[model samples]
Target chain A: MKLRLRGVRKSFGSKVVLDGIDLDVGEGAVVCLIGSSGSGKSTLLRCINLLEPLDDGVIELDGLDIAEPGLPPDPIRRRIGMVFQSFNLFPHLSVLDNVALAPRKVLGVPTAVARVEALELLARFGLADKAGDFPDRCSGGQQQRVAIARALAMQPELLLLDEITSALDPELVGEVLDVVRDLRQSGMTMILATHEMAFAREISDRVCFLDAGRILESGPPQQLFGAPQHDRTKAFLLRVIDAGRLER
Target chain B: MQQEPTRRQRWERRQRRRSIAVAALSSTTALVAVVLAVPRLPGYRKVRAAFFDGEIFVDTFGPLARAFLYDLQIFAWCAPAILMSGMAIALARTARSPALFPLRVAATVYTDGVRGVPVVLWIYLIGFGVPGLLQSRTWSNPVLWGSTALIVAYSAYVAEVFRAGIESVHESQRAAARSLGLSNTQTLRHVVLPQAVRRVIPPLMNDLVSLQKDVALVSFLGPVEALRRAQSFKSSLANFTPYVGAALLFLCVSVPLTRLTDHLLQRERRRMSATAIR
Candidate 1:
């Protein structure tokens, strides 16, 4: 499914978070959104999933009007699954149950069928052994992978990953990225808001640099990373690369 | 590492054993003293007359049996009524509806106001005052009036307990349930309430225990329950032994329940801790 956002504007009281934002992800394309903190990258991703109500905008998902205020949004939301930064898996539920919940409750799948599908997804994410375990018992990377598997259990057409690896430890980040890389190889349409520049360049077909609640530049990985046209993009790339080195 | 036991450590261990032994000896001695004293106490003659003399005890057994049957009947009828009414009021208030605000306020006021006063006052009001004010002598049936009073008072307290239980669930659980496409009611029934009820089991069991004790208070209305029977035996036999007998009867019913509640609460705490570790 193709997701297109147009003239999106969201504000919290007086502070403008998303100001006249616009972006799009073509069918089966991996679009990476990169920006520093407080740049509204996460808010933009939340708008796509309708987790945050948009103040003003049109978000079209697979030709369906999700941004229309009165429209029933569950049908659209069901087709678009989201993975949050915190890996918001239900702590009270087992790994298999967390993945099975949406399918059984929302999609009305039978319990046995949902469990089978959930186990298969967990196996794919290398979490089959942890199926009976709760999220808190798992490592950060394992939890994030289970979260991704949970989203996939909904059989969504488009996956919205909002800094999924940002909350992981340095050593744990690679395992979660591997899952995303596997998803990329499987031709899943994903819009990833992330700080992992190299991963974005490695996996994303296009990279969109956002600054101050707007897209400053967007293009193929080679042009954006190697020969960026915008000065803001260059500055951001330099700062990020410098910060990355300092962390190491 | 061969180390001599410190004097304080050895003394502490000895003290612990001494206290346990003292407690056991004192309890047994107290039990024997009570048994010996019972025959010489002021009411022993009358207690013997009631139990062995077969005068008041046999004559009152019929009424006592009838009262016991009536008590069971009242519990059967009133428990569900109180539980349903209390649960409905609690769930409705927590439903977050504007219309239920008045009901919630009324329920709160009722619980607080009624519980603040002695239950004896409520019994008198329901049993005597209401009938006098309504000018209906038929409302003089002590059984009906007394049960009414019990239900009203117990319902208030139970509603508060239920409300606290419902609120004990974390807000995130509700959000998660909603995100799963369950409606508000479905979320409550499937997700929120089950967890909340589990959390409140200990308190709810305590309420049940207190409620059972409160049943004895209904004897004041004069239908001759265990307490009333004992009271009458005391007056006729002129002694306190019947009170002791009634107390023993109450302990027989309540002690096992208290232990069961404690056991269940302990198990629940262990389960919660294990889940939290996960």
Candidate 2:
């Protein structure tokens, strides 16, 4: 579960989103990426999951380079699950089918077994009764939870969450975050892009401050938030402080 | 016990009653005028005798009904082929592979080339030409050839409908599925196509409605469907009662189908709005 990105670079036509990024995510550790908007936090997670093609880099999951050309992304992707900010649950599928589809279709698990596993997962996520409902029938928080359950259904080694709670209402954010906390307690490896400063400081093992597609600083949460070495980190933390997000 | 209404309520009720009375009186007056005026009009009796002859209609009904079965048969046989071929053409047009470039071009050429020419012309050319080429072969029926022409021509239009449905799925749907280890094909099958087809059902049903009626054009190749039966009676009886009967039969099918399509469209709209409420 050791995820390494060495000299990872990504761009969109003229804009460079991830500029020579380098990082390491240890097994069973939670790495929180904190930054302002357009800071490449989401893009980095996408690159790591092989959802976006990297211009240059070596992304190694347990020392196997996954970013190499001709290395099929699907096999690598099955081991690494990603939950998007938008929830991206298939609108046509029922909540249970959304969770069970990948396991049944890609993993070659039988439908009955997959449905049983899916129901168990839904019950664990407190959406057991809503298994038959479509994604649109659920609240944003519930849908986000289902999206996480869908990614987790594959039993992936590494989970990448891109601003998973930013779309939820203030009151709804806590329920989704609670699932993330439970995942952390269970020692599932994760890297998440988040604007929830308090949540990040509470749950993260290491915090990486990405500014303009580069990690300005990486350290323990207390050091990065309480006593930041980089000036940009201080300025960003000051904004968070003004916004009343950071706790003493 | 009945209570006396308030003055304003009484006035409103009176106005409503008066309006309903006026509407009924006017409609009855118009009907009387039309009935009185028709017999006085020149050539009315002869026209009615020719077009609405009961005996001719009774004579034509059985054959026309049997002939319509051919139309239904063609639709049943060709509709599935049309759907499959149309979907395949749509997928080919949308495919991004360099290896499929030739196929994409060919599909593009077909939809564009076939759509511009009139469908009847396709029926004429393929029906007569193919058999002429294959004179030695046993398969030389113009009706079969016409059915083939209908499938080829209509499939282009249907493919465009299918393409629109496929593209209507949001880009995020693809991203989410692919990120979950599903390949592009799996993503399309499991995620995109299902939603797309759901959204496009109303329009696709509309196309099928048109397709059902277009089955008549096969009569040009002398398949003896309802329309051709009408034409045959036109020549045989020297009257138009059979044509009117045929027209009524088509109305029997298309009107119900049109109403069903309308109901489906409304249901789709309601479902969309309900989902949007969340």
Candidate 3:
């Protein structure tokens, strides 16, 4: 396993967001978390990234306790990249600069070398023509692709994608998901929090249903989507189907 | 193939021309009324002789103009100092490290304390009070002390502006940078400050415009700058025209800066509206 989370808990004053969460992501596996808005999927991803302090429990990356007291998150963060739902590419930077920033600044790579690698990554994502364009000039799908390319530039052991396509238009959704599918084919370890039940069913190696800050049911995508054992999981899938989000 | 103008388009063009003609006519009439009526007032001649004497203006203009360069010099030096200190204070205020808590508190106190005091009083206290207490002739130079006071006083206001700019950056940008493994300082330097500083250019220019005029406040400490020169001319020649000359000099500098700030503000607004569409 590349990542192990056991009994992870997080709370904001009186409100608990992630309650005693436990999960494991093996090397080159894709785990998709599907649930309603307040189900703690995004929060769990953030906790894994060490962006939010875990109120309780252990997060072990390669058997090293990452959530221990005062371990500087910067180095750990470099090893695990995250792409937010909003596609938070730095607005002031050009598409090329956005992808090149971390390699040049954090990794201490020379600017010329970083630019070459960034261009290669951008070209891989079919964004070669957008190297000089600002984030505001790019379409939503293009921006999300650049965001994924930016995260990939770090060469992380694991990537956390929090609702990456949720903010995209329905017509633009496939392009962004195509990039994810390609990443999966390249054997990148990824954890995705998504509202797209159909895409989760299609692309995920494992699908976990989250409800009220806990994973209620988790299994292979076929079993979890086809024969969910829990009533809440079944109800959630029914609602998704009713909303025309998931195909029968 | 050519097309004739639409009937509504022709009517709209005529309306626009008539509106322009009305505007021109109304403004000219107002200007003519003011010009024809002002001189007939009972005290017009006395007021003009006292405040707008052509001879006094011509005589004192050179000296006052020369004195105005000192204001520009003070502005040139103080502007950079204010910007640097303002950024420092703003950074201190925004720092998230627990170790920097005291520094943040100190920055807050300094901003509040300095902003509470009037600039003129700060100048008097620093320029005269400190010099008197030190009892050193070298330290008693009001120009140096007065400029210091201006920089100190103005930095507090500028720091708030900078802090506002810094805080205006969305939290997501910082998260994105931090997730890329950049340290907090690196994220701030590389990502946050660049966007923050760009957003604040127009407001910073406004502050600089205000500072350009407030540079004259240093004359209170007896620096013999433009306002002081105008004062001397007023006392000696017993005419206020030299003061008008000094005011004209101030207007010459400030109006252009004010216009530039407005232009930048408009351009930024346009850019924001254009980009926000996506």
Q: Which parts of model 2 have CA positions greater than 4 angstroms off?
A: B1-50, B261-278
True contacts kept of 2: 0.64
lDDT of 3 by residue, B1-278 (tens): 88898999999999999999999999999999999999999999999999999988999999999999999999999999999999999999998999999999999999999999999999988988889899997788888899999989999999999999999999999999999999999999999999999889878988898899899999988888999999999999989999999999999998988888788777765553335432
TM-score of chain A of each: 0.96, 0.98, 0.99
lDDT by residue (tens digit), candidate 1, A66-147:
9999676566677877887888777657889889988988888999999999999999989999999867778999999998
What order do candidates take by lDDT, descending?
A: 3, 2, 1
- What does candidate 2 score on TM? 0.90
lDDT of 3 by residue, A1-248 (tens): 48999999999898998888889999999999999999999999999999999999999999999999799999999999999999999988889999999999999999999999999999998999999888887899999999999999999999999999989999999999999999999999999999998899899999999898898999999999999999999999999999999988
Off by over 4 Å in 3: B1-26, B264-278
Candidate 2, residues A1-248: lDDT per residue as tens digits? Answer: 79888999999999998988999999999999999999999999988887788999898999999999878889889999999999999987889999999999899999999999999999998999999888877999999999999999999999999999999999999999999999999999999999999999999999999999999899999899888998999999999889887765
In model 3, residue pairs whose N, Cα or C atoms come closer than 3 Å (at least 3 residues apart or on different chains), thus clashing, are: none
- Every candidate's chain B TM-score: 0.72, 0.82, 0.89
Q: Which pairs clash in model 2?
A: none
Per-candidate RMSD vs. true structure? 6.3, 4.2, 2.4
DockQ for all candidate structures vs. native: 0.23, 0.51, 0.64
lDDT of 2 at B220: 81
lDDT of 2: 0.90
DockQ-based ranking, best first? 3, 2, 1
Per residue, candidate 2 scores C-alpha lDDT tens digits across B199-270 of: 777777777878888889988877789999899889988999998998888778878987987887777555
For all candidates in order, the CA lDDT equals 0.79, 0.90, 0.93
